[model samples]
Target: MSGDGVFSSGVLSCLAALQRLMDGNPTVAQHVGLHRAKITAGIVSVEAGFDRGYLKKSRPAHLPILAKIEAARRSSVSSSISSTSSDVKRLKGKLRLLEDELATVLTQRDKVLTQNIQLWERVRELESAHRNSNAPELTTLT
Candidate 1:
């Protein structure tokens, strides 16, 4: 698909060349418009010549497997994207629940601390009262 000169890729160039060859537009190919003669000549040259290796007619056999491989790669990418998004949603939900529990625990801890302070103050008052009641009266000297 690159415009990197006419014959950059062999068959790739031939495909673009084919369009021009068939159009018969003078602007496209000047005078060498899609002649049945030229196409037949090219086909004959390819067939009669002994240059039979990669560019032969047998390569069409690979198209089906190629299509399947492309489909599978697309499917895997889409599934991975979905799974990653789901994991993020799950983590967000867990984070919210944990934050709620932490707040409740903090509130309960503050209440317990306040209760302990009040109990300590009551204990100090009770102990002082007991000492005062047990103390001997300051009687006048006889």
Candidate 2:
């Protein structure tokens, strides 16, 4: 489609994408499925009108409706992307909090283990001292 926005598969996608970006409407972006920069080159051909390009010319009348459709599509798409991004950010924050908690727990475990080891060593030393001290001396019988 030319300025009118009537197009088949490839042309329609290109046009639709351009329509989305230039329009910056979420509804169109959703339908087009990409960002604005990506659509720019494709729109170059469209800016010239379909008559200048390989694709057949879309009538001028269709442009306004197509633009409207693209606008709505882009608007919805933008909305979805914005919401999804916000969700991802929230999830990332939660993940960071969990990781911090995990680290704290691991450090506590290490400290407890060290304390246990020290206690066990002290007990062994005490038991050995008691055995040596309590043992009776033996004299050899001739």
Candidate 3:
């Protein structure tokens, strides 16, 4: 095979190896260091049994593999962002529910306090009236 043909075959093999890693193939994952590190060009090259030097940016034949790696990285990042956004939304909903419950409890406490104050005032009035009714009558001696 010519140099271009060999590079093309190597590129195709690397792409296949990347796909296997993405698919969670255990053997491929271990071999490519996917289980311990992120999917990088060097890892993919190792998985495809290709030399890492061929993956340099100066090589036109290697550009496609690099592009594929970048695309996979972006895809994982966007998915992670979306999942984090969903978690934030869920937590916000829980916080709103807790705040509402607290408001309800505070309202009930205020109502009970007002009722207690009113009962205390009524008891004081009754005590004053009882004291006045029990007062001894004054006798005037001429």
- Per-candidate Cα lDDT values, in order, are 0.52, 0.59, 0.78
Top TM-score prediction, candidate number: 3
Candidate 1, pairs of clashing residues = none
TM-score of 2: 0.46
lDDT of 2 at 68: 49
Q: What TM-score, computed on C-alpha atoms, does each candidate reach?
A: 0.49, 0.46, 0.60
Q: Which numbered prediction scores highest in lDDT against the true structure? A: 3
Candidate 2 lDDT for residue 142: 100
* Candidate 1 segments exceeding 4 Å error: 1-59, 135-142
Q: Per-residue lDDT of 1-142 in model 2, one digit per residue for the tens?
A: 3454344444555455455555655343232445443443324345424332433236453455445445655776797799899999999999999999999999999999999999999999987887799676556799
**Model 3 lowest lDDT segment of ten:** 28-37
Off by over 4 Å in 3: 1-4, 26-37, 51-54, 102-142
lDDT value, residue 26 of candidate 2: 30
Put down candidate 3 lDDT per residue, 1-142, tens digits, no spaces: 2465887788888888788777766344356435422778887787777766547677787788788888888888888889899999999999999999999999999999999999999999987887789667656899
lDDT of 1 by residue, 42-127 (tens): 33223323122323344454233334334544665677678889999999999999999999999999999999999999999987
Q: Which scores greater on TM-score, model 1 or model 2?
A: 1
Q: How much is the lDDT of residue 130 in candidate 3?
A: 72
